[model samples]
Target: MSLALDIFTVVMVVAGLFFFYAGSIGMLRFPTVESRLHALTKADNLSVGFIALGVMPQMAEATDALKLLLAWALILFSSAAASQLIAIAARRNRRRDP
Candidate 1:
């Protein structure tokens, strides 16, 4: 049972890493600021959630798991808010350029 949980945790962490890497590449390859923001925000949320999930099972105490999840939630909310602000600024800039 412990071995299975370890494997699951490892897999989640690896998947999260992959998502982060993909988001980085997307930022470089995407043509528009909006697209890059989309990729970054989506991947950011997924990666953080995955990492938190991985940590939850490994934590020995319930409070530790809850704290990890709470941190992730805070980060996710902030990232989403920041992304919206950035997107609005980008849109405004585009409008002014033309």
Candidate 2:
């Protein structure tokens, strides 16, 4: 039912937040840029994705669902591309340094 859906959404959001926090801690504790990036990518993409998916079913209408889906898609695409670019830049810098 709707109540069950709401509870699920809330749980998903909380789980996502936990992941984000975990990632933040990992990034801070990590010794290298690459390690930090790994933490960042894991946290950013998955947390956002989990949260978005959680909210998807609660959307009010078809248009609202579409909008949410579009937003999720944008986040997914951009995060992946940005992560790749960051990796490339980091690798390039390492190459230049040694």
Per-residue lDDT of candidate 1, residues 1-98 (tens digit):
99999999999999999999989898889999989999998997899899899878999999999999999999999999999999999899989996
What lDDT tens digits, residue by residue, belong to model 2 across residues 1-86?
Answer: 99999999999889889989988998899998888988988787788877887898898887886787788789878887888898
Deviation (Å) of 88 in candidate 2: 1.4
TM-scores of all models?
0.94, 0.86
How many angstroms is residue 93 displaced in model 1 relative to the true structure, after the best TM-score fit? 1.7
Q: lDDT of each prediction vs. the true structure?
A: 0.93, 0.86
Alpha-carbon lDDT of model 1 = 0.93
* Pairs with steric clashes in candidate 2: none
Which residue pairs overlap in candidate 1's backbone? none
Q: For candidate 2, which ten residues in a row score worst on lDDT?
A: 60-69
